[model samples]
Target: MRSYPVDSPHAAGRILALTMIVDGNLVGSELAALSRSKILDHIDLDHADFQHLLKDLCEDLLTSTSHGAIQVDNALIDSVLEEIVHPDLRRSLLHAMWSIADADGWLADAEAVLLTRASNAWAAETNFSSPSYRRP
Candidate 1:
């Protein structure tokens, strides 16, 4: 995957896009939830830019595919997760991810895996003890 500056809008958008596709399908409900939440605006990313980032992420993942199956590199995902350094940004992004995962009314195992991985990774860097971080 192409590199973007730490905490850059592109990085944030890429992560969000990854969340949308982690389940191997991008549903309309997920897109609608993202649009309604306006989370991209929080990172100064417009819808057009977000779509571009999503496309770029898809291309990157496709390039790394082997034998017709996409094998996502954990190191690459970690690097992208590390790009968002701010605690507030991490929290917001996590929230957006959870929202997207739940948008279709069913959380696939793949979605849960990505969400758990991101939450654990970010929790190690920042204090997530607050009740807000708890799932209802």
Candidate 2:
């Protein structure tokens, strides 16, 4: 798990930024869903900013994976979650993650693991149930 808290000032954008990386593959629907997401607004970002950040994050992930397998930075993610004290916001972030994972119509094993770890971590932090991603 590579630490991406790499001095990014975009605290809220980290969830989406990390989501794009966790699956190891980026699909069109995921990008589309992310772009259409109102969650981005709640994260203090818009579609445009999200796209820009995703692009950069993807590049970084690519660089990291060029060497070997990618891993989710659980500690870094938890640290990010720590900054978000609101239960609603944490739940929203969890939902956004599930949305990204399910965007491709199939949630890969790695994606599921990432979502589960994130949900558990968020729930532990907020003492609230993390949102689930239901297929449509």
Candidate 3:
């Protein structure tokens, strides 16, 4: 898939969309946690619009699957992370991803893999200087 522009209006939604799609499927708890975070508000999407965005993201996954390639590239993740100019937003994005992964009360192997990729990608993009600073 082609990458979106860093300043695209959908950039923030894309981040959340990727978080939801990274594990290849969305669970009820993850969706609930995402909703609770009011992420859609930040993206200027209401619930109905968010549902449509989710559908679009799922379609991209389906298309990738049909091509026999269903993986999310680390480079793509880093590109997404690069769009977040603010350190706090980057940290928040990482935290939200972890929350999604743990929402089911158990982090699946697939979820863990995606979360690690995202974390490493974000760190690489940000060039984090402090080893002691943890996600807030």
Candidate 3 to truth, TM: 0.72
Query: Per-residue CA lDDT of candidate 1, range 23-119, in tens?
Result: 7899999999999888988999999999999999999889988899886657777888989988999999999999999999999987887888899
TM-scores for all predictions: 0.92, 0.71, 0.72
Kindly indicate the candidate among 1 and 2 with the higher TM-score.
1
Q: What lDDT does candidate 3 reach at residue 123?
A: 75
For candidate 2, write residues 11-105 as lDDT tens digits. 55766767766667777898777766777766667667767776776666566553476544666456655555567776777788888878888
RMSD of each: 3.4, 6.2, 4.1
- In model 3, which runs have C-alpha deviations exceeding 4 angstroms? 7-9, 66-69, 73-85, 127-136
The better candidate by lDDT, 1 or 3, is 1
Candidate 3, pairs of clashing residues: none
In order of lDDT, best first, we have 1, 3, 2
Better of 2 and 3 by lDDT: 3
Q: How accurate is candidate 1 locally (lDDT)?
A: 0.89
Candidate with better TM-score, 1 vs 3: 1
